[model samples]
Target: MNAQEILDECAALYTLPGPPKDFGERTVSDRFEPAAVPTLITNATIWTGNNNGTEVIHGGEIFLEGGLIKYVGDRVPSHFTTNNRVRSINAQLAWVTPAIVDMHSHLGVDSAPNLAGSADTNSMKALIQPWLRSLDGIDTHDESYPLSISGGIATALILPGSADAIGGQAFIIKLRDTKDRTPLSRVLEPPYSLLNGTRVDPTIPPRWRHMKHATGENPSTWYQGTRYNEARKLKLEQDAYCAKAQAHQWTGLPAQIPKNLKWEALVDVLRGRVKVNCHIYETTDFTSMVGLTNEFEFSIAAFHHAHEAYLVPETIKKVWGGVTPGVAVFATNARYKREAYRGTEFAPKILHEHGIPIAVKSDHSILDSRFLLISSKFAALRKALKGGLQGEIGQWYKAVAEGKIPLVVDVAKADHIATLLELKAEVDEYTGKSLRLTLTHATEAHLLAKQIAAAGPDVGVVLRPARQYPTVWDQKRVLPGPPLSAQSSVGVLTDANVTVAIGIEEGWQARNTRFDLAWAALEANGTLSRTEALAMGSSNLETLLGLEPQTDLVAYRGGDVFDLSSRVAAIISPARGFVDLI
Candidate 1:
């Protein structure tokens, strides 16, 4: 078929009609009935939308009907007026938090261990490149998503970098490593603002002009006046090129300009849809750009690699909306030609503390699974390690990790967990539990149980029955009464039992209370607590993103997301429509 005919056929197949005429509020269609719903979920510890763990109901049941959290507190409703289509999961010590929502990332395009080849990632030629959307180059097979999920990251905001004086748009994505039928549907779009662009901020000033001198009786030194004109001409040409680029006015890009892809991207910036992410650090440059940005009517969204943010904190805060500094790029004397190295990470943390609604991101080409979180944590810790106690940012994290004054801080782990938690809490709070829970049985869970049973009959016993007693059962003897009694002579094992605990006590205690001694302990040992490490990978990360976290958690005793060490299997009943790991 001709190209025209093909286009026409495709258009016909894709169009859809608008909403029905009677779609007004007064008239209800057969489309949705809020009253008609079903009951689901049994015996789970729900991290209530609030940040309080005590608010978390342990061993309680939740019922979802018509996609809403119908009955939430304490127990499931005994009576449903309608034929209750019920689904239950034995949430045996597994968490039931919201899904994770990572606020900062570049998952789809730049995968892990980024190499030099992804330079096409940015269009630096143009001072502005707004039209360059990231979704166009997103790779479904980007290894970063899978690696992130291994750390329990569910959703992410994949954004462009501040390469050009202006950057491109941003995209929100889910970290689901599967054969997704629709790639575009997975991305969420929202307007991003780039309040500032990149500027070179130096710690030490360079020796320029070296005392300009003009002597009437100049001596004939070396080349005296020989070929001086030749060098001056070259320098003037170089200066002119820079001057022309700097004088680039939007008065309809020069007609002679080729159809440059970078310029094309800039058109979008001109239209004001994409935010200009400038990499600025100096006060003078910042002042200069503010006027330019105002004239263009485009705002600066973020500032990247801002080393001297503290110098112009108020000015930067007033101009650019956000700042993300490097974690370890400190104590350098390179470009300080004009300004002094005020401090590292001071810009972001101070701004964040002063209510900038900060979101820390790793300015990396390829996504490093742990870099985002680790980088953020390092920023806070480095400040703490430098400021020594007066630093609120470091103290906040230190307190979160039980304030163990460890010699070495696993900033990476702390940062990861922190972001995860923040993201989770945001989602849960915004969209109350209306999740479509699909319980898939993991055959591995059953296999692992078999192996545990095969260990020995004596290995299956529990001396004291705790709240999780039923979950802790000896599979050596399936039947509870006589068979279990007969195996009693073999003796009971505590730690070896496969049963898990899903209580929120630990998570709660970690958040609500202050544990300076604990942090001191970590400091003394040069290590973070296990809970703190886990938080780095989970809670802390979610919190940072300002999105809700999917805590509909499913865990395996023998194996974590990284390595399935145990041979456990989960048997799912089709009739029940859900599976529980026993």
Candidate 2:
């Protein structure tokens, strides 16, 4: 190899990852749309996501021009206002906040409608393929982009699925569609080295690269191999390759730096240039991964779906480089698998009290990224409730006289009451039996909460849709939340000591995450604060995913973001360099 080429390769290996030198001074964003128009939004209540996400500005204004946030305060400067080309929007005291960021998502790769060929989230070719990129699998036609954007998700860290130990490299992307309509156009701060393969321009600082790693049940069940040992062997092989190249062992007339695409990404991870996001659950898995990081002298950015993270804060704090890996988890999604059997709703609060950063995630297709905010709301709800709920599944059925369907509301209410009583009787009968029970879609469960609680603490109830609606004959007596009823079913069940958790019924309901959270807080009767609600959808997710600050903003018209009266008005995205009116 030429002397200059070898020197460049060695130098790039040691280079660290960060933003460009002109990051803050740039007038236009890298993702800016050429057709974007300058926009000014005035008279809004802005949640700037500053001051640890507590900063709010009343009667504020924001100036967006050339895809950058030029001014954010009480007034726009006269110079910007006088520009004839700028468009103005009166938010009319609406709430404006940073657009939501889903840290752990598989939106495009997983794709919606669930077809066989569309599933590209995992590659089963090998258990330890780090060179595979999620970007390559992204389907531009994925139906979730606009849906996620409608839910205020501007940016997402598209991660590979957990089917492999070292699944592949992950990439961050803006959710907005670009004119080019290609996956590459949507990438945010793509690694410069990606353009020229192994050759990078030495002048520009390296951008942060992300990778997905999984341990515990997923890899064990999928590949039937000892994941930790295999991962360790790969790291050793990478170390040898990098060491040989750095030491200039190859001397020839025409030669290239030693490179193995399979292990190259892993080598960068050892050099501390890649942010490793892991999929782990049990405490044992966490300990193994922590030991791996310390032994290899690398760092994990965050642990995704870490149901047991709250149980071992000290162990997480002991990670390499003294940086505790952020814990990203679901708010109440648990117990469907053995690995998450001990998962609790109070995990976020417990971890927070231990000085550990926490974030709530959707896991995309698993929980629907559009409703990612609901996870945060439930997290906050658990914190406020102080670990008072429990139970898994419970069922009740009643026999009615054939063809004796009642049309009257009073008759239906009476029948509903009778069915609930019968269900409670069955619950009592199995109180101490060797059976686990969970009540799903318990629309009228609140009516017999005392009876259900009396049965046992092991019986849990799951409330779907957050709010109850009388969409069918069985749900005729569903408790209407808010003004009609002082408290929602969630409140009644909590008061009666029934373990309750909120969930969505279908994929379409995911877009209503903000409304679900607002309704949950409203039904709580002031126990859940607006700031806490906002964190469930914004800062909390960012912390959990170990992501950089988001620059996209969403404007809600008429009232605060949590208010049902408010509606999304426009989206100001610095990442996409444009203002979009919804």
- lDDT string, candidate 2, 238-277, tens digits: 4565566667666432355456666778777877888999
lDDT of 2 at 170: 99
Q: Compose the digit string of candidate 1's lDDT tens values, residues 1-582.
A: 133333332232222222334434332322224554465566788777675345687887766655345666566657742454566667763446665555445676665546555433555455344456676666775656666775556666566554443345566666664344344546532221211231122211211000000111111111232222332343344344334434654244332322334343333333332344444555665565554545444345554344555455566555522342221122222244333344344455666565544444433333354444444454544444333355666564344333222121111121232333343233334434211111011111222333434333311211111111233112122212223332221112112342211112245443312232232223323343445434433453343222256454445457643232533355455545677787
Give the CA lDDT, 0 to 100, for residue 402 in model 1: 37
Best by lDDT: 2
Q: What shift in Å separates residue 142 of candidate 2 from its native position after superposition? A: 1.1
Tell me the spans in candidate 2 whose CA falls farther than 4 Å from its real position: 196-200, 221-254, 372-582
TM-score of each: 0.38, 0.63
Off by over 4 Å in 1: 1-87, 93-100, 113-120, 123-128, 177-182, 189-286, 304-311, 320-349, 363-367, 370-582
Task: Work out how many backbone clashes candidate 2 has.
Answer: 10
TM-score of 1: 0.38
Worst lDDT 10-window in candidate 1: 206-215
Local distance difference test, each candidate: 0.40, 0.73
